[model samples]
Target: MNILGILRDGTGKMAVGASVAAFVAATCLAALPARADDVTWTMATHAGGHWLEHGAQGFADKVALYTEGRVKINVAQPGALGSPLTTTQTVKDGIAEAATTWGGHVQGIDKTGAIVGGWPGGLRPEEWFFWVYEDGGLDLIKQWRMEKFGVVSIPCDTGETEIFLHSHKPVRTIEDFKGLRVRTSGAWAEIAAKLGASTVVIPGDEAFSALERGVVDALEWAGPGQNFKSAFHTIAKYIITPGVHYASGLTECIINKDAWDKLSEHDKVMVEVAGRLNLYESYARYGELDIAGWAKLKEAAASGNNEFIKLDDSFIAAAQKASNDWADEQAGNNEWFKKVLESQRATLDKLETWDEFRLPIGGVRE
Candidate 1:
């Protein structure tokens, strides 16, 4: 069925007659993958609510379109297939074909997971694009996951800068954090402790009650949009600024190795392409949602219910030092963590050269 070889050796013109054309079509059809490469996958996810649900659905839609319906992904909510913490494990164990997961949820299994999720003073969401697509980080993540965890990993979704904290007590300075009780998650709790804050983890379902009942003085969950969804603004008196804990965050889509192996090469690439498209698209759209949420938060501020508090700029340097020290400790603890850390920092250094030369656009952001 080597049609090209037969045509190359034919003693005739390159133009195909009707019989040859029909024969070539038949050969191509026969050469294709079995079932015409049609595949359907359940995309189990750790995220059930907020913009992430939309983002996951968008990824599924894109996969179908990019593969021309040869592949289909049906996204499932958290606990639909398994619990949030079990998402990656489900994919790894082949109990699920794929999952979109927050790496922060798996830090116990791999400390590097938290780094991938997001850490204080790390690369922003835009910076992640350079590191992943241009700086070979994608290949490294893929190789590491396949070798160590038996899954295909793609940097699939990103969230923008989050709220620093919703505080009952105003955090106007670094000192204000001293003895401040906060309910938070991920790497931020470690940094918060260094800032003299008492950090606690409360169940997400009870976070509102915790904040309302003075169980925790402050809470930091996500950006404005998600925070609004959780109604933190309704109770906390102070909305802190500059989410240094996580300037942004990354989440991955993982596929079972055996399930991925069943895909044709073209469809595999299409999935990756769909992931890349959704990564950028989801981040931007989420930011827009945050902007609208911020507007509503502003109205609440104007009504004398809550105050918008910007911590002194000096807190930035203190946070940066603490975050870097914690990151170094992580790098020293694991090889994969060390590699990704070096790659991200090195890429940021290179980008910093151009960033320093560019003129500011002259907004508050400058």
Candidate 2:
């Protein structure tokens, strides 16, 4: 009745889905272990709501099917293990076997981690996939994690939602940013700061309350898709964008190095297969639903529930220039910053055609 035996009895064999052969090569170094019974682990996220309900559940389901239930992961959304910041530590210290963590959310430990999620004008999904999966970006991130945190990361899922300003009052131009307190994160906050807004890093949960209490006059949360999910639309009437940012937010399904090592070859393969499938599925799913979300936003705007605002050409130019300059400044001191930016840019160049075709895949083709 040991866990491994239960796992093996539960999931008799490991099977790959349609895509595993294309991405990973089987190796004797990490061979399948003798089945004992069962293997169970916990997966944690910051938002245990719809995002994980649909997105992370896709990973959980595949693990169950691919491993035949031998390897079962109980999915926890909404900081079940702890805050997003603590999830990094939880996985590393084996407090939780696996977790969904974002780089920006853990600046207390590694300030650079947030850069993977979104940058001012960073890579889109196609370029991001090529850079991380094909162009050694994933390897580099793994090395960085090992060097700094002792956690092993798998690219779980990623999708871009437009970064826009939701404000109590209409903010139509750069001038409107002046003296306003706005909620933002990482480089976007710096971009807002450069444009004259004072930026605060509030947890996503507090954003609405901050706006309601006038703690922040505006906020650039995710696109209409997530804003609706988070219910920010109920508080803020103006949703403005110069298409200023997009979050190809990476959620790492990281496992403790030791626990990862203990996984049976069969279980390990199942994890990898599940990770890849989850990434593709979540990315594709977000791309699909977000289009409808935008349409819903437009309909709401028409009905006077919300106002969709766009940045003028001049404001976009100024914001882009400011963001680029800020990135350059950070690059001089942050080697990883330079490395990721260059890798992303180079990959974007190579996938110029893929980007062209992939645009419609995720309707955030700005």
Q: lDDT of each prediction vs. the true structure?
A: 0.77, 0.70
- Name the regions of candidate 2 deviating beyond 4 angstroms: 1-34, 353-366
What is the Cα-based lDDT of residue 331 in candidate 1? 89
- Per-residue CA lDDT of model 2 for 124-232, tens digit only, reads 6655666776687887777878778898877777766565788887776678768878888766776778899899987676788899888988887665677767667
The Cα RMSD of model 1 versus the native structure comes to 8.6
Question: Per-residue lDDT for 101-195 in model 1, tens only?
Answer: 77667776777777778888677878887787778788878887776678899887888888999988988777889999999777777788988
- CA shift of 277, model 2, Å: 1.1
Which window of ten consecutive residues has the lowest lDDT sum in model 2? Answer: 1-10
